[model samples]
Target: MDLSSELSEFLRTRRARLKPQDVGLPEFGRHRRVPGLRREELAQLAGVSVAYYTRLEQGNGKNVSMEVLDSIARALRLSDTERAHLTHLAKPTVKKRQRAAAARPQKVRPGLAHLLEAMETVPAFVLGRRGDILAWNRMSRALFGDFDSWEPHERNMARMIFLDPNSRDLYPEWECKAVEVVSVLRLYAGMNPDDQELLSLVGELSVRSEEFRSLWAAHTVTDKGHGSKRVRHPLVGEMTLAYESLKVSGDDPDLMLVTYHAEPGSASADALRLLAQWGVDEPAKPADVPE
Candidate 1:
């Protein structure tokens, strides 16, 4: 991954989205060469010299202070997540010696799989670096398509959303889901800027899915939090499920424990019960949560 190029593009996209009047500056003429504020205009807003801001935007952020980044972030009207992304991009997180560390696949901690098993009624997953489905419970198999059946390389949420046809049926609002997945993936990419595997995934997705390519160009950054998702199950039909993503305490800080539920007495809740019973009727499958 080219950190400098990523940094430049992220800043450019953010800058292009704004206009002179959008940031309280008066628009003097009807037309301009660029879509958003010019370098001079952004530099003025950031209280910096044109030369310095240009250099920073060109991806030469060495020795750039947090105060300068904060000022530029404010000028761009960036959100908290975007602000963090900017910081990560401007300041490279991984050193040259640490690039080799990216090769190691993240491992889930001991007994985390059991937690997923304990929540039999809810579909749960233990996801590691770059949305890898490191572990999942039997209920998850019932709710989500069988992860156990997929190859390790195929067990990724982002890949499934775009490349897997089953995902189209699962997500009613597939476009929205794709954007969110890409945004989360972008945030991770910004942090682990040199993760070869992640870059490879991005390259493969970009080559295969036009939607993924477009979303990747947008450079959206978002954090995963509690949210509601509506999925259509082949057996039970459409259901709105509430999901919570909790960052678990483990060796891998990025490991997430994601679980889904539905409101009590609602049809969606009943659908979950039926799925659970169906899971029982079928032959018991091994809960292959990685050790």
Candidate 2:
């Protein structure tokens, strides 16, 4: 892939998403020629010349300083992730290196696995960059209702969400879940551009799921954390749970730890307790928790 073209497209797309009113600019009450602020307008706001801004957007200027980048970022109102992406794109080393490491499927850290064993009351799991269910605690197995019998290739979360009918039944708010999936995937793509596994997963989803394809085209990226999810399980019926997606430090690209919780004394919390009991009482199904 052409890095220069990618950089240009990303900046241009982000710019196109903003309106004059979005940045507190005066609206002339006339038919606008562009959907967002023009190059000249943004340049003026950022204290740069239109020609210089145009050159940077065209990828012709490689020696852009951090001060200019920060100025542009401020003008565009970039979030932390977007700001990082811009810096990554502008850095010479990212373009100089060709050996972008592919993402390895995450393995449950032994300490994390032991921790999971200890947390019998809640469901927790490790998800790799491609959203593969790499490892989970016993209660998580019961909560997700996925038998552990799938081959390595079928273990990805995105695949299960799009291809598995069970996922549709499990998540009551399927559309919201779908958007979350796409948003997280977008985060991964920006963070790990050369991950072959990630690229493969994206290709497969775009081919098989129209919803996935549409969302991918929109180029919406988000940081995933501290979200509420509604899940419908056969054993527990429906429960709304708050989830936290935490990054495990020192891990390579795309590995994370996610856990779900409900308030004590709530119906959802009760359902989770029931799930823990089920995990203890039921026979250990290795097939239910595939390797």
Candidate 3:
């Protein structure tokens, strides 16, 4: 992930999504060459000189101020997440880029692993950055296939979603699920562009899947911690599950606890119960969910 190229492409894509009238600017001509607002139009909207904005767009963000970035963000009508991504792309951490290729492994806490085991009737996974499943419980295995049998790199959600054929059958709205996964990965990339593992995963997926390639170029960003998903499970058929993704607050802020539960009275809940072996074969708590 080249910082300069990424910043240029991000700003270019964002600007290409907006029109003059979309931001209250009057439509001046019908023969516009570009799809969206011109560079001068954006500069005017941000109250900056065209030359300065052009320089920033070309990825020379040195000495740029947060105030100017915020003004540009407003002009582009960026969401909070997108704004944060913009800031990150403009001012990446120099040390992370200069650091060694080896990134420290992300770990899940022992207590959180116990909680995942206790969620016998619920499908739970302790995911690290880039959607790597560091640990998971039996219910999760029953619901989403046996993660224990997979190699460490194969346990990643993004990899499974895009490269695995079974994943297409798992999600009824596969495109929606794929977009969400890709968006989350991009958010991570924005903050940590120099993550070697993440880049390697992205490169592999891009080469293997056409869908992943297209979605990766879109540059969507989201930070929502909770959502609902409809999964087409092989054993239980199609069911809707609401999920919460909570970040661990202490030393491992990168680890996220993802838990999935069905509505109490819905058919999905009954399906989940069946997957848990009618509450009979639940396993004892574990010391930690191993990666």
Query: What is each predicted model's overall lDDT from 0 to 1?
Result: 0.88, 0.75, 0.85
- Estimate, for each residue in 1-291, the C-alpha lDDT of model 3 and write its tens digit: 887888888888899999988999998878899878899999999999999999999999998999999999999999999999999999876465333432887666777777787777788888887888888888888778778678777989998999889998999999999999999999989878778888899999999999999999988888748989999877778999999988778876677888899999999998888878833565643323455
Q: Which candidate's TM-score is highest?
A: 1
- Which segments of candidate 2 are over 4 A away from where they belong? 59-61, 92-105, 250-254, 283-291
**lDDT tens digits, residues 61-148, model 2?**
4888899999998998988877877776665354323334443334565666666667777788777666777777777888885546
Clashing pairs in 3: none
Which of the two candidates, 1 or 3, achieves a greater lDDT against the reference? Answer: 1
Question: Model 3 off-target regions past 4 Å?
Answer: 94-102, 278-291
Give all candidate RMSDs, comma-separated: 1.9, 3.2, 2.5
Q: Which ten residues in a row have the lowest lDDT in candidate 3?
A: 93-102
lDDT, candidate 2, residue 15? 84
Q: If both were scored by TM-score, which would come out higher, candidate 1 or candidate 2?
A: 1
Prediction 1 TM-score vs. true: 0.93
Rank by TM-score, descending? 1, 3, 2
